[model samples]
Target: MPRKKANETKTYVLDTNILLHEPLAFLSFQEHDVVVPMTVLEELDYIKDSKKDVARDARISIRSMEDVLHDATPEQMTEGVTLAGRGSGITAPSGKFSIFSDLELPEDHHVFTSNENDNRIINAALYLQEQKSPGQVVLVTKDINMRLKAKGAGLAHVEDYRTDQLISDIKYLSKGYHTFEGRFWERVKSVESRAEGRDTVHTIAKNILPEAYINEFILDESGEFAGLVESINEDSLEILDLGVERLMSRHAWGINPKNVPQAMALHALLDPHIDLVILTGPAGSGKTLLALAAALEMVVEKNMYDKIIVTRSTPEIAESIGFLPGTEEEKMAPWLAAITDSLEVLHKNDENVKGSMNYIMEKANIQFKSVNFMRGRSIQNAIVILDESQNLTASQLKTIITRCGEGTKLICSGNLAQIDSNYLSAVTSGLTYLVEKFKNFSGSATLNLDGVVRSRLADFAERHL
Candidate 1:
């Protein structure tokens, strides 16, 4: 509902991908007649053959459009939801250039597309604008640079194809690479800082800064605090220790993944009273395995919860994965390996446990679900583990967490720094988003796992590489 000048502009140009991304974008221009801008249609010609999912998704989209267009029929194509190309009987607006108006391409930025196509798309809008001056013609594209180009060409109006995105702002976070060299980092409960120096620091900053090394001693990865920020304080790092009884309890989970930090995280998570735990670690940290094991034990032996719920983002981009070469179980062998490996170790340590988790799997006592099916389901009295939680967007993460039912405890674990998609980075991922936003709330604790315990070689690769 953005308003532009009441000038004569009346036509909206749909970028080819806009239709493919949203698939239903064609009908969105109902308030005005939309121009596919002949050149935009041509762009689809090539994508029609792409070997990627986006390309396949594109094909499905174009076909859907065909129905809409055909259903409208030539009669309907002319005035509303019509199919006539620009310059047809509708009269080409002023300043409008012929289809795909020829233009010189800038060598640097124009390297990807044969400027032949992009320029024409731009010209289509320009042409419609000129002829229908004051008619309000604007270009809608998914490309950030493309939007900038439209502005540079004097077509100041443009918008993103928001089909795949939700508009909202979340604070950005930094991925600090600290070695935790004993002397430099001490886990404390609180710290204090003053206007001037001296340990007698008197101020009530309290444990306001939960992740700090000390109250007044703020430092970066280099162990110094004077570079970018100046805050006076004594902060606290609340630490909880779990003894062997708690470790051997029916609900206990000893993480085998090679990260020493899980030892601390396991302690925090084992406390039945603390219902929510967030674990963030690098790729091999074993966050998922630990959560899964805890969930299994809590269900099987402790009778702590009715079942174990596991979920992760679909990683829509990684889908083909090709069917596994084994039986249905074997096909998912690779994906299930992580979960099973964790279970194997859990059983190894606790002789009281026996058999394949097949009983749980067959009975659906332990549910392995994709993030796609989690909508609107209220999960209760269960131990829920949201694996690869970093891959989730802030809103998606919030949605997943809100699904937890009463007596349900949810654990979100993933390395914010290890995201596989460009749409979101460490600073903006849901994992870090949760850490920054929910840090101080009681009954909620987060443990940053460092020290790769995967193996001598694994540790070496993690630290050196």
Candidate 2:
């Protein structure tokens, strides 16, 4: 596929994961000078030390340069790939993106490798800023907060690496159903009514938010209810009320009116056609439960969706694996345990379901695989639920979302403030990050899931904790 070129001419220095954003991300830098800091290379070396998955991801990133960069020979590469920056060249040129190697980490002199390495890489870009101070020395990073700290330190310009944003907010998305926005009430009155009676109520309901109910009539010029009733789900919204209705339809197991998240889930379930759906909320909220119900209704009851796939971010749980030594699955036991608890809650040890559950575990479903396994494959027709998505880097989220196949539905649910991903905060974590970006596209919907449907104790924790 021909890469869509960016018209901008800023100098974009990438943190390691930015290099990992699908092939097109790198190629998109057509006329720009892309910088790969030496510290990032050091970090990749350490990352590749973990598992075959990390090693494989590292290779994919390196291969992105196959069309443009070349290897530096002994005479040239004496300093390494960073210093001897020549890889196979095949790009439009005005001086290619420079690999600025030779930066130092004050701590290890080992040239920053971990988070320490990420800091040093941006430090190198700062050094570059001192040297060239170009139009905008933008450092594109998936490290949510790195961009912030970098800006605070001195890199004046920092932007998200999102070529595409995940559709998260319901109002903004190009829904399956067309909506008459409240914003249109003013203009539509000027231009004739773009939408008729029922649409007017849906539009007003969207404006009011939550469960929409109003006594006002949708009158024509003659001032009447227009001989039609404008009724919305006092508990749930009609599928036709969504900008993304084609993806959502009336399923036998409907979303509960009290469960506002259900209102959001229907959008995800209805859109079996949509491959990725990000649903986020705090603890005590029914993010996981709602997801399970949707999967059951679609896969078991309706036979629309294929399989139920569930995973979560392993950031906070990485330490547990350090104590248990074995294959990666054994290592990830603690993180994946949360999903198991949810599964247990769903099945409660039913023999008929146990077999399929065991298969999911052996095959990496229950205990089968980690997000690392999801990278290369195009997951299809399956309901992929990523709980606690807040702990993922934007790049990590991108990798997960792109892994979806033609008939897949990905549900990403997490509380923005509750993230464990290094350097990520409420605004920058993967959950909210995907939400803010893709809130306005076709076949995509995101629900912030405001109300806590769990017990009072759990709700109190999310509120105060």
Assess the local accuracy of residue 207 in candidate 1 as a C-alpha lDDT between 0 and 100. Answer: 50
- Model 1: what TM-score? 0.53
Predicted candidate 2 versus true structure: per-residue lDDT over 271-336, tens digit per residue: 555555666656767677667666766776677766767776665445334466788766666667
- TM-scores of all models? 0.53, 0.60
Candidate 1 differs from the real structure by a C-alpha RMSD in angstroms, to one decimal, of 11.3
Residue 427's C-alpha lDDT in candidate 2? Answer: 56
The 0-to-1 C-alpha lDDT of every candidate, in the order given, reads: 0.57, 0.57
